[model samples]
Target chain A: MRDNGAMQHSARRDDTAAQPSRMQSAVFLPIGDEGRAELVERRIAEAITGGLIPAGERLPSESALARSLRVAPVTVREALVALRDRGLIVTRRGRNGGSFVADSADPAQFTAKRLGAMSRVALRDLGAHYSAITRACVGLAAARADASEVARIRQRLANADAADEKAWRRAADEAQTEIAALSQSARLTREQMRLQAEFSPFLGLIGQDASAREQQRRAVLAVLDALERGDADAAASAVDAFVRDSVALLIDHQMRLHRA
Target chain B: MKALQATDAPAAVDTVTAFFQRGVDALGEGTRELAADVASARAEGPLTRAKLDAIVLPYAQALFDRAGVTVYGAGFIAAIGLLNDASGHLSWWQGPRHSKLELAAQNIGKEHIDYSELEWYRVPVSTGKPHIAGPHVDYLCSDEYTITVAYPVFVGGEFIGVHGMDVLLDAVEGELLPLLSGETEEITVINAVGRVLVSTNPHRATGDPVRDAGDTLTRYECEGLPLAVLVS
Candidate 1:
């Protein structure tokens, strides 16, 4: 029994390994010898996409950011320029002069473009990849999460509301992240955070629909019920179903957008 | 030293495996792009190192960024480079690669960084599988402590080259050493041959052979690579 459990755990981890190989074209970026600008750009972009840096927030001045990041001022300037070029940030002149994240950066458009470019096979493969990690995570959480962890997840799920697309998406990420964290595996949690940061902007579109929101709620409740009972298999299955349903919705939505 | 706890072994393995797995995933993405380029004849016939750099380096950079991994360098190597140009072996390195100093020092025209024999390249080529080579010094490349994760690239049944990345030894230590949960217990990540990759002990650093021979020690094989961890 113990050996089986170990094997299952390792196999699930391996699933994450396989998914990235298939996701090759979706996330490539150019690296330059002077890496600081690119590094700063990605960090800022992630913060914005992850909602840590809200839309319309003023960024620190070029020199200030450079000092903090320990990069040359030119590097910060280059990063700001790139961000501006992408319309992710805007620079204001005069006393109010500084870079600010654009209001409604519309990250969804970018993510949707990438998703729309992928073949159905790639999309399904990605969906399976996410499902496997999440299933493993929730399974371990169901069997091992402490009272507080379970309660925290339950609280997050209960509080989730789909009235606003941004809030709902944030809640979804928080809920998934909480569940993944319950496994006490940093690797799983890190990957969860990355996936949410990369995909939530696009997934938020699906949450804007009432029926989709209801289905998501049902899935979350089922997983919560399994966790409450310490049923690892049930928790795993619930998460799998939830991810599959979400993936199907997203793919259908993407196909429509592609056709349009 | 303390004996391994069954509970901790899995986490330790998970941490190391995740690091290596992410590298392979990035290479897989790069290989796909390179293969597509080759098929389209976009880069055909006597592909110069500079041409290969322009064509493939962006994907490598993207992988490095998306994964948030720190590495000394990462890029692809064409096998046929040796038969043609002198500097063909080192096809790509991250960023504005092959800085003038490195170019001058490494003697691109005369010297050969013969990768065909390196375990990282050789194992993957032989098995037609991905392999992790060395937590040892890469004198030919970084001249510092590093491990190379390599994947073989094949097009039309022809072995074109290998896509690879080099993770600094200190970075691996920084990433893997803190996974040790106990004060007295030690964790050492090892390759299939039991060469230490990262360890909680400074004396048993990267490239040092694990003395325990992986026997009587709680050894857990890292998924996705023929590597294991000895938590003793």
Candidate 2:
């Protein structure tokens, strides 16, 4: 296991909280067996929408991405082509040129498309995976996070304007990611952040609904309160409930959009 | 030798230390020379990106080429990062099947990349000392575990920025393993922060904390480098 000291990738208080790809391995985990261009496209699209590889940051070279993902370089080229076509990434040439995530990526645009395409099972599966990692992470935080650090996170939990999609998403992201960093296990924290990126597009949609945002805010605070009280099980359950509620909301949203 | 005793540390591992000393010394040598080159270029005119690239690119790529496959394996010392606000980050890296290094889009995008916040960039600027940050993921290009050796560049006493090389962890393991392998005692090489860089012991992988054996182990300092060999 990588020590937490070795895991400090950013100068930020929550190293996992950065938009840039601080933990490339976690975000760029290999795509084993599935070599389809669409799968590659989907993987990168999620990373782009989720903010693992933030806007304006250059992507790894095609060959490098292929090597890490264990796919053909041509496959990566194809994926890049798709992402470029969708206006998610733009590629340039010359000394300081490569494919960069576009400067203004509306995560809502990507999420709306994704939710419509995803089957109910896929949505639930993603939720289950994310909830499992977040639960483990928060439980560890409750057990290991020092009181001062926990308090610092508590202070930073901004009161997000629920009606503003961007404001609510940003606040939710910062709160959840900083709390995950408190786990003090760099690997777990990085993994949780990456999964959060994949989960963000769906979560971003919930910010438009005031009640949904309030529910998420309370669930996150409940987890934080549990952590402060040193109740590992309570923190885990709180996050589980949070994920379950969000996934159900997303599925319902997806159905309504399809019906309309 | 005096420094080792002054710190009340263990013996100096000449052989092991020399290996890193050579690499770091070479990396430092380039930046020093580049600093002089930049100073002269300024004397002639303004230091434009083109002007800087004309001098920096060829030299940095040559350094990568000279490092060769033996020490670096598949992961040659990655592109040399020339970072400063004026110059931004200009990387000269080995592209796919390329003979010499060429400028690659290793954070070439002009927006959203805050180079100021990275430890490798932060430490040298803060202390004016060469810093090695590693056993962390490479956010620049490759997604592998990496070690970045960075040195500050000063032009006419003005802190311009830094020039550094990102060395892959596996390449590091390959370089140090031969001398360290097959030891009866556990001999692990750790970075300045006490994270294992490489180890003769199979269990202690890179990034694992070096556990002190409580008087059972002797710590040997690697002169002039932020590294030590722990023997138990």
Candidate 3:
């Protein structure tokens, strides 16, 4: 019996050690620092993006985690609190108690309603960043993209065409997301996604002008064409020009509306 | 002689099952009542500490009793009082453990556990994926063992948690085996950390890590189970 217990203990230890490998294969980056709350937060975020932490899953309790990590319970609590404020996790009390991850995917209409709640500056800043980042993405895509990726970009443009103003906005957003995804950099993709979420509400507020929409579509197509041609410099320059012009147009429109 | 007799007899799995089933039912009912109380409290405006406890404690106690579960060596609700801020004062509202758990259960029958509170649930500055908390299970049968089940919970068009019950295996082998159907397949529950919370086969109850269970007749298999359905 004692031998059985000892063997079981050793096996369990091996299993625990093996668990990290399983997570690593699934794209979850192991947290490095013991006490740094930021490292914990970043690891959780990466896990979420990597799909290791599925939507609506709960986190471990503070006491349980503290013991496992060899850290103070307070540190765990602090990290959880930070996650909660970001609207990532929700908490409850009573017999069934714990925290859970929140789902970010919502319909276009829902996204629009949320966007309507943003401050003016938030919207403006978001527009600026989207314009800038998207432009960079298109340019990079033009230089480094392959035939299949370029085909995917064209399909996104077609989706944009099929959508209404709101739907088009969503399609455009998806297109930008795909661009980041194609970059194959988990860190860069996360950063861009964060920026996009922050400015989503403002992006929804932008008016749908037929001529402007057509111009944007043409610009995107042209950028894709440059990438397909392998003209990296030209593609980058075109994207830069498009972003500069779009920013100016948006700023001018906003100023005119304010003046009126 | 009585204590020896009790120990000599195997623990009853039926009793353990009944205990857990009763506990889950009680928790579910208590959650509904708590939801109503929270709504009323919110409507009453900023609540004093006394009023909050006055409203919550009774219901919490009732919940623990109904579930046949104890906390801090007493009914589970008593454990609520132990959570204190740096000042040693009861700090319920400062954390969202209760709210998140309640919401998770209500929204999805799953409960979430957090190892780090200060980093995940802090106010103001936020870090990590705001919508993604961390790795957690949607269902928990017990602190040690959990079973995966079909049929997820969806509230307000969202998956929240999972629902299941746990049984103490030693007790089952000792007392409940005689009561169970002869053809009843072996059952066992394991938590995220791979601890055996309960089991039906007496030979499986070694009080060791669950992952160590080899292909012995006493060992149970739980492959292809959803990670969300286990205790984490």
By lDDT, the best candidate is 2
For model 2, the docking class works out as: incorrect
Instruction: Give the winner by DockQ: 2 or 3.
Output: 2
Cα-based lDDT at residue A96, candidate 1: 68
Best DockQ goes to which candidate? 2
Worst 10-residue stretch by lDDT in candidate 1 chain B?
Answer: B101-110
Pitting candidate 1 against candidate 3, the one with the higher lDDT is: 1
User: What TM-score does structure 3 among the candidates reach?
Assistant: 0.31
Native contacts recovered, each model: 0.00, 0.00, 0.00
For all candidates, state DockQ relative to the true structure.
0.01, 0.05, 0.01
Which residue segments of model 3 deviate by more than 4 Å? A1-140, A161-163, B1-232
Residues A110-213 of candidate 1 have per-residue lDDT tens digits of 56666678787877787777778788777766655555446756776677667766666656666766666555444566665556555565566677687887
Local accuracy of candidate 3 as per-residue lDDT tens digits, A1-260:
99768756765676668454654445434545565676566555544443334457766667655544445778768887887887766788777688766676223333344444445576557656766665565554454345555676677568565336645555555555555444333344556656654443334334356666666666667776776775757766766666566656655555655566
After TM-score superposition, the amount by which residue B58's alpha carbon in candidate 3 deviates from its true location, in angstroms, is: 40
Clashing pairs in 1: A29-B62, A32-B95, A33-B95, A33-B96
Q: Which ten residues in a row have the lowest lDDT in candidate 2 chain B?
A: B70-79
